[model samples]
Target: MRIIFSLFLVLSVSTIFSQEIETVQDSAIVKVDSLYREDQFYLGLTYNTLQQKPQGVSQNKFSVGLSAGFLRDMPINKDRTHAIATGLGFTFNNYVQNLAITGTGEMPFYTVLDDKTVFNKNKFTQLLVDLPIEFRWRTSTYESYKFWRIYGGVKFSYVLYNRSLYTDDQSKVVITNNIDFNKLLYGIYLSAGYNTVNVYAYYGLNPIFKSAEVGGENIKMKAFNVGIIFYVL
Candidate 1:
């Protein structure tokens, strides 16, 4: 009887000891995974509009912009929810407006078409390399995939290729790599939302044209964009 009681007591203590060991291992695993990062890759599509437009200038059709890039997320806090990110990206912007580009050489004449002027297409396109730096804040955890986040940043873009096309029943004018455009573009942008989809906006800090003029007025148009952005692991 005494031997049987001793064996039962030993078994109970062993079971409790094993359970404590397992709990410690599980806690260690969670601690290691808490140092996770987010928003390494992103793709965005935006509706583009012109701000500070010259008199009589108006957009004709849908002006769209597409962007894709990778960002390096660096956490700044112990919880890993506050971070700073910087990355390199590419952007393609198409602006469809009534700004007519005529003549050639070092300078191109700019004219804003009136309602009486009939045209099939009048648009300008830009392909740019983008450098983005952002400050990010989020309510995220290692186990949670859906969380709220807000990211605001400044983006610097360099135009690698540009084109201006105007066509009508009377004539067609095509300009490529014109020096009139500002090659270096900088802007402020903000993105905020939950989970994968975010609302995004960008406002250009400088004019689109360097020193171009339309009817004795400086072409001071800047870019304003609003759209959706997605982030991937």
Candidate 2:
């Protein structure tokens, strides 16, 4: 389903640009056509980390994930160096967590792990779709492809899928719920680099769970991601 969605997004962007090419007489369009490339798709792979997860929920430092999607870059002024990049994107994140969740509806919380809690594996994953609005500035001409650029923005996402897993010596426990998770997530991101390889970083602005409790105390966790962004233009 995700692969299909990505294809649809790419095709939709290509179709839009094709329509614009037919109607607009701007030199930028002509230059873009001459380049024989589309500059609207972005793909990223990132490392995920937990911030403020229940006091003792240990995590692997390098839990990683990926995201891909399309963007529309709309120039803001006559110089055309500054623009707003807005689009839909899909993201998947995985965290290697050691803390176990043991919460109910009214009051949700997590338990800390001690030396006695031996485990082979434990992880949490989430799939989401986001809308990003960015302020973009680039040093590029219609015919130039290798240029320095900076893009920073806020993104809002809806969680489409989520799962948790726990495994020990003999048994595996999979959890779809325990903590009361928020369906919506919002964050800010920044991407900057020359050419196609850009550095990407994101920080969540809201908690992962809604009014949840940990060891009888209200606790919240936010996510942070940093990685490389690839622009297939």
Candidate 3:
């Protein structure tokens, strides 16, 4: 009877010890997983256009944009579903339009080319350094690699380099770093979707050029962009 009682006690203690060790291991795993983050790096491609264009100005060819960046995500809640992110990025933008810039100085000539005017190429390109601040919300967890997300933000850009080129049968005109362009630009943007693909849009709050005139008309054209963006861990 004594031997049986001792064996039963030993078995009970061993079972309790095993359960305690498992509980500690599970707790450690949960604590580590709760600190996971999402969408640290991003790449995007956009179709670029002009908004609030002058009466006769129109886009020509394909105006394209490319952007890439990394974001530092800071979770505001315990679940980490909501976050605020800020990052630095670079953008390359090309605007092919009927507007012609003819000179390379502080006071350059601006013209809105009519459809009858034939030109081989007329476009302006910009390289900008972008700073983005955004609010992020996602249905994401450590175990779920795919989820839905919505991110909205305002971006500030500083133009690093700019060029305008026009070519035709008669002559070729090129302008570099024209002072009329707004060196500092700001815009609002939004992105939303699931998994790896998201739709993105941006609307510039200010004009692309400052004190730029076309036929005695003040040029107040803003930029508009729409495209797809991808996020990666």
Per-residue lDDT tens digits for candidate 3, residues 102-127, read 97756679988898899899999999
How many Å off is the CA of 205 in candidate 3?
0.3
User: In candidate 2, which residue pairs get closer than 3 Å at backbone N, Cα or C atoms, i.e. clash?
Assistant: 108-213, 109-213
Off by over 4 Å in 1: 1-32
Count of steric clashes across candidates, in order: 0, 2, 0
| Sort order, lDDT high to low | 1, 3, 2
Clashing pairs in 3: none
Cα lDDT of model 2 by residue, 50-153, tens digit:
88866667775569989999998787766567888788999998888776653333343356666688877777788899999999888877677788889899
TM-score ranking of the models: 1, 3, 2
Query: Which scores better on lDDT, 1 or 3?
Result: 1
TM-score of 2: 0.79
The prediction achieving the highest lDDT against the true structure is 1
The lDDT per prediction is 0.94, 0.80, 0.93
**Which residue pairs collide, candidate 1?**
none
How far residue 181's Cα lies from its native spot in candidate 2, in Å, is 1.1
